[model samples]
Target: MKIYIEDIAKYEGQTITLQAWLYNKRSSGKLHFLQLRDGTGEIQAVVFKGNVSDEVFELSDKITQESSVEVTGTVKKHDRSKIGYEIDATDVKVIGESVDYPITPKEHGTHFLMEHRHLWLRSLRQKAILRIRHRIIKSVRDFFDNKGFTLVDAPIFTPNACEGTTNLFKVDYFDENAYLTQSGQLYMEAAAMAVGKAYCFGPTFRAEKSKTRRHLTEFWMVEPEVAFFDIYDDMDLAEEFVEYIVQEVVKHNREDLEVLERDISKLENIKRPFPRISYDEAIEILKKKGNDTEWGADFGGDEETLISEEFDKPVMIHHYPMAIKAFYMKQEGDKAACVDMIAPEGYGEIIGGGQREEDIEKLKAKIKEQGLPEEVFNWYLDVRRYGSCKHAGFGLGIERTVAWICGLHHVRETIPFPRLMDRLKP
Candidate 1:
């Protein structure tokens, strides 16, 4: 019967057929050691020359790296194998042949690997990263689902920008221009008014021209919004949300973490009650670290890193300057009631959210002050006019969280087929 490599351990002592690819091959005078990988996992298959027909042995010798084949063999418990299982192959059938694959076992440059990203995903490292990414997404959905948050899907094509037009991707939409959604927080707010607690998870776009490791032209975000919640409630939820997702990934993807060589201890320390410091306190910490930062100045990547280094876990900086924050954020005097969760180990902000302004007049004036077309936000203003209560929400960057969990250097590796500023093919 055809089976996957991940479940081979369950069929021990029984003959099973696995449709796999030859991940690697090494042969002795009497036996051929073939490393095979199917999508689920990898296992070592030993083909004894004396036991199998000469034709089968010859077929094993002719198989090349990444060649698809059906390996009929008896599963055995092998404690020394990487996957804790091995197969004694009695026959080998090549389904397809692969010759001189561009991505070999040896390392290739970033540009070359990216050019061949379609094939580069076959490597174990990439597989492990993507597996963890899947786990992160699952945990995110589960966390919200269990918390009574309804799944609300936001529109991809928006008539206007959520924040500003400078960083939005404007596209021709039939008769007029429409921009790709940059964040689902605005829609989540409307959903919150309807369902009490709501969330939206999907792709987001940014047209900023940045070449930094943290920048990506397209990425995914999971935003949660709740009615009758204030800024402090938002911070509490953010703290619990971050802690849960981190621990969930660590719990379920331990093997993947091991494959990535991530420091499990670092992630284990990601508990709730994360350090919450006001923007003023963060400025003090940065100043102590010899940063030339001053009050009311927005923190850049370098300043964020310096501030986050003060704590071992994620640090939440709240009460940012009103002038720098989005107009939707509620303001107290000169500070907006917003927060940014900066990840440890130099990973910058992974979440940005806060109490949304619910006052209709204030919201309208803020929208006009930001040079936004008030008519475009009439429906949003109606949210306040019809029935509006205190509400808050936050948007978490999925790629940055994955990169931090996997201890990756760039956000590009966190997602499959990442869209960047310059590269687009494959």
Candidate 2:
């Protein structure tokens, strides 16, 4: 029977055929050890000259790295194996031969590996990262689904910018100008008005010229909006939502985390009630750290990193200056009722959100104050005009969160194909 490497333990002691590729291989005097991978997992296939026919033994010895083959073997229990199981090969047939694969079992430069990212995914480390990423995505959906939040998709091609026009990716929408969405928060607000609680999960684009490790030209975001929710409610939800995602990943992707060498202890400690500090307090921390930051200035990468180092868990900095925040954010006397959740270990801010301004006149005045196109937001204002209630939401960057969870230094490896300012190839 045909079997996948992940289910090899179920057929122990039975001869099964595995459609796999040669991941690596080595040979002793009369025996060949072929490292095989079938996408689900990897295993060592031992081919002995005395146990198998001469043809099978010769074929196993000559199989190159990444060569596709059908390996028929007895699934033997091996207590000391990395996967706790091994395949004793009885026959092997090469379906295709791969000669000189670019990504060999050696260290490669970041640029070289990025150029070959299409093929580089087959590597064990890359495979593990992608698998963990899959779990993260699934966990996100499951968390919201169980919490009674409906999935509402936002448009990729937007009529106006959601965050700001400075970093917008503009496009020619036939006769009128359009832009790729920077966030789905605004559309999600409308969905929440109709559905009570809703979220949008999709790709967003930003035409930023930043060359930092945390910046991506195009990335995925999950924005959750809830009607009749206040700033404090938003903070409470953010903490619980993040903890749920981290715990779910730790539970399901333990083996993948081991492959990535992530410290599970750090992830395990991420529980509800994350440290929440005010913006004024965060500024004091930055000043004490010798950073050249002022109270009114927005926090950059350096500022975020210094502040996040104060705690082992994610930190929430709230009550930012109104002038520095988005126009839709509600005002608390003199400050904007907004929050930014900085990830621990210098990963920077993964979540930014606040209670939205629900008053139609205040929303319009803020739009005019920010010098935004008033005509495009008429529909947005209509949401407030037609019985709008207090609402709150937050957007979480998927790549940044995945990088932090997987203990990766950069965001490029978190996604299958990352679109950066300079990269658009395979």
Candidate 3:
């Protein structure tokens, strides 16, 4: 019977054949130990000369790393293995040969590994990171799904920018100018009016000329918009949403976390009631930490780090200066009802949004003041024109959140293939 390593425990003590790749191997005279991996998981298959025929033993010894093979063995419970199971091989058959795989056990430079990202994913650490990323994505869908949020997909190509034109990738669309969607918030807001709550989960592009650890030329974002939601309601939802995802990851992805050497205690401390402060309060904290920060100045990576350090959990900074915020946020005198959720340990802001302006006049005036294409926003303004209620939403960066949860240094490893400002191949 054919079986997967991940489900080997269900067939323990039963003989089964595993179609796998030779992840690695070693031989000690009469015994050949083989590390086998299918897509689901990896396992150790011990081959004894007395159990298998000479042809099987010779094939096992001759096979190279990543060579495809069929390993027939009896499953045995293991106390030390990460998967909690091992295989006692009775036969081995090589289906394909791999000659001198470029990525071996030896260390390689970051650039070299990136250049070979297609093959680099076969490594144990990369696999662990990707696995945890899978769990995070699933957690996102489940959290919103249970809360009755509709999964509304937004367009990738837009006639105008959602955030701004400065960091947008303008492209020729049949002679008419177009740009990649930077955020799905605008479309999601419209969807929220139709449904009570709505969300969009997909890739978002930003033609940003940035080389920072937090920046990605193209990344995935999950934006949730809700009708009849105020700034305080939005903040409350953000905190609960963040706490749910973090706890889900911690509860389900413990083994992957161990593989990444993440500090589990830190993740466990990501419980609810995250600290919520105002923009003025955040500036005060920054100034007390020796930063020459002044009012109305937007927070960057360094400033976000300083503010987040004040708490062990994620911190929400709301009521940003109106000048620095987007045009659609509800105005509160000199401040806009906007919020940014900064993660602890210097991960920076993972969630950004707040209550949107319900006044059509204010939306149109802000669009004109920002010098945006007024014609393109006519549809957006229509949302406020007809039966508009107080609405709010937030967008969370998947790559950055994964990096923070896994304690990764860069955002590149969070995705299967990272598209950065410079590197984009394999």
Candidate 4:
């Protein structure tokens, strides 16, 4: 009775019971053709007036789209069927009936579909995107787990801001103020010192007001921190990690990829040893491309795309100016302070990481130079004061990565329930 929709293909010449919802139906006088879907797949059921009882025939005629039903049918091979299988229904029992579904099998506007995202997710394309997202999440944990990286959970509520308070979502935590975490890198750094290597994967929040296809107020980020690692080692790990995730999705979700209409050739070219470029070199390349960018400023979205276009695989741009990077990033001599590596092919900075300053005196001076309260980060500074080793880490946005791999224009379609700056619902 609880058979999957996919199992109907092998049940030829036998009576089977299926519980599903009516996806579509066509009636020709006394004959009826019904399409049933149960999440996994869809199957066509043919009901004839003369082959079944009057009650069953009438029930099949009255069923509407999305009406939940239980049907008893005999399976038969049909050459005309789209899936090479058909069911001849002897009985039909309607369990639930929807009043009037808004979504039909026709084209609809993006705003309309996003407004009705709850019901829109029942469509095939949305289902495939969510499934691929799940695969990416699984692959992330699997890669870190196999590499002996401990899974450390960072607190959603924190006392101090990792970057700054400008774009942080502030919340009232009892009497004090707490903000939603923007990245798990800081907390994972301490854990990495304790556990040798650690990674944290969870939802992060940002109060950015930008309405871009690539931006989200609430997104998932996976941050991996390692002690005794330098910027070069960090870049190497980032490339290999990204390559593994892409390979896993390609290996396991080929059919889902096809449903999403992704060009697998682009992802096939994504592998380890992504092209690495320094901040100075990227500036030179951008200058040649007629981009009005300076050496110290961070790369704009368009500039990042242009630089990534020059390489076949993902590109890593490292050693950014200290003033342009986070306060915690270690300064490289007198030229630059931090390093950042970006993915090529228009992925746009999939990995943001750098070497952290481990010296207590240097970190204290840098915190003051950034005009941040040292008391707020006293605990963070304790790591450097007591026993700290050279450490490096990076945060990879899960939605952006999935959108790039699946070739989706908008990041919202990649997640089942996307929480944007203005929209937050089913």
Candidate 5:
């Protein structure tokens, strides 16, 4: 009878056929111990010389690492086994022979592993991280679906850039120029007016030239837009959304957490009502910490770390200078005051959002002030031209949020296939 790797624990004292790849092997004369992995889990199989035929014993002895094989064995309950179950092999047959596997049971550098990512994904650590990433992605959709948010897909190809033209991947669209989307914010806003609340979760491209841990040329972003929502409501939604994702990871990915060696205690304190501070207040704190940051300047990486470390929960830094922000953000008072939120524990700003200027005239003026072509954004400006309300939304980088929850240093490992400035292949 054929059985899966996970079902081996329940089939004790029964004969079963197992198909898997030989992860590792140990042979001591007549006794053989083989660790087999079949994607679901790993199990130890013991093949004694007397328990199997001569052909089976010889095949097990000569089987190379990662060789695909099938074995008929009797399931046995072994209390001393690491995986809580073992298989006593009675018959073994090689299905596919793998000669000179590139990845051995030894350590390799990051560059070398990335070059061999096709096979490196089979390793225990890489497999665990990717599995956790899948869970995170699932939880994101589930959360939004549970809420009344309609899923709206934005276009991958756009006639004009959303942020700026400097970091856009220009492609020829039958004589006209098209660029990949850097954020789905503008599209989601238009959808929100139609659906009340809408979100776009997909790949966003940015042709950034520098190679930084946080910057990726192409990455997944989740942008949610809500009609009739202000900056306060935006922060409330952002906090709750973050808390939901972190709690989901803690509840479902215990085994993965163990593999990553994450200190669960740190994540345990990540509840809602995270610490809130104004941009001006954070600047004062930075200056006290000897950061030398001015009120008009955006928070640097060092300043962000110091501010986030002061609190146990994620910090919500609001009312950033409008002069340094996007043209769409609604200006507060006479000076520059727009809302932004930053996560604690040095994760930096995972969300950038604010109340968009509802008045079409003011928005156009701001666009011109920022030196952006008003003609290219006429479609976006249409949202305000007709029945516009005080609406707000934020863009959350999915990779950054996952990296923070998993306590990973680099964002590349959060995604299965990361496209950085230097890497494009598997």
Candidate 6:
């Protein structure tokens, strides 16, 4: 019977055929040990000299790394094996041979590996990270779907920038100039009013020149917008949302986490009511820690790292200066009524959200103050003029969140294909 590596445990002590690729191979005199992977999982296939025909042994000897082969062997439990199962091969069929594979067991430079990312994804580490990413995406949809948030997809080509005009990737829409969307928050707000609660999960583009480990020119974001939800409610929702993703990844992707060598304890400690502090308080903490960050200045990567180090779980920093925030954020006298959630262990900010401006005149004034084209925002202003309520939402960077969960140092590895400041190709 034909079986997969992952299902080998069920057919223990029974001969089965596995059509897989030779991941790696080593031989000792007359015995050969072939590492085979079939995408689902990997297993060790052993070929004994006297037990198999000369043709089978000869075929096994000629098998190179990453060669496609059909292996017929008896499955057996081997506690010594990394995957806890192995196959004693009685027959071997060479389907296809791959020679001169670029990626080897030895270490390679980051640029070299990234340049060969198409082939590099077949590596074990990349496989684990991609699996974790899949689980994260599934958990995101499940969490929002269970909460009754309609999946409203926002457009990729937007008329105006939601974050800022400077970091927009300009494109020509017919005769008019259009820009790639920085966020779906504005459209999601409109959807929320129409559907009560709405979320958009799609790619967002930015033309930032930053080459930091956290910055990506193109990345996926999941934004949830809810009408009648206050800033505090938004923070609470953020905490719950983050905790849910972390816990789900931990529970479902435990083996992948083990493969990545991530410390599961850190993820387990993530709970609700995450450490909450005001932006002023964060600045003070940074000052006490001898950082040079000033009160109204936007926090940089290093500043965010310093602040996140204070808490074991994700931390919430609220009420930033109005001058530094987006123009449409609801203002509380002198400050923007918004919040930024910083992930633990120097993951930086994974979420940014706040209450949106509900007053039509104040929204118009802020839009004008930000020097945004009023004609473009006329549709947004219609939300307030029609029947805007206390609305709140947040955008979670999918790559950053996956990196944090997988305990990765760079966000580039979290996505299958990454678009960075200096990287646009495979």
The C-alpha lDDT values of all candidates are 0.92, 0.92, 0.91, 0.86, 0.85, 0.92
The CA lDDT at 378 in model 4 is: 91
Clashing pairs in 6: none
User: What are the per-residue Cα lDDT tens digits for candidate 6 across 238-271?
Assistant: 9999999999998999999999999999999998
Query: For candidate 3, what's the RMSD?
Result: 1.5
Q: Which residue ranges in model 6 land beyond 4 Å of their true spot?
A: none
Model 1 TM-score, all chains together: 0.98
lDDT (Cα, 0-100) at 409 in candidate 3:
90
Give the Cα-based TM-score of candidate 6 against the true structure.
0.98
TM-score of 3: 0.97
TM-score of each: 0.98, 0.98, 0.97, 0.96, 0.96, 0.98
Off by over 4 Å in 2: none
lDDT of 3 by residue, 1-426 (tens): 457778888999999999999988989999998999998889999999999999988888898999999988899998987789999999988899899898988889999999989999988899888988998899999999999999999999998788664588888999898888999999998999999899999999988899989989999999999999999999999989989999998998898899899999999998888898999999899889999988989988999998988999999999999998888889999999999999999998899999999999888899989888889888988898889999999999999999999999999999999999998787
Give per-model CA RMSD.
1.1, 1.2, 1.5, 1.7, 1.5, 1.2
What is the TM-score (0 to 1) of candidate 5? Answer: 0.96
User: Predicted candidate 4: what Cα RMSD to the true structure?
Assistant: 1.7
Residues 1-426 of candidate 4: C-alpha lDDT, one tens digit per residue:
468877877788999988888989999999999989888888888899999999899988989889898888899999988668888989899989976889998899998999999998888888888888999999999999999999999999988888864589899999999999998888988898899899999999999897998898999999999999988888888888999999999998888899889888888888777888888899999999999897678788899898988998888888877777777888777544345555656767777887888888888887888889999899898888778899988889998898888888889888878888889876
Worst 10 residues of 1 by lDDT: 1-10
Q: On a 0 to 100 scale, what is the lDDT of residue 238 in model 1?
A: 93
Q: Report backbone clashes per prediction.
A: 0, 0, 0, 3, 0, 0
Cα lDDT over the full model 1: 0.92
Worst lDDT 10-window in candidate 2: 160-169
lDDT at position 315, candidate 3: 96
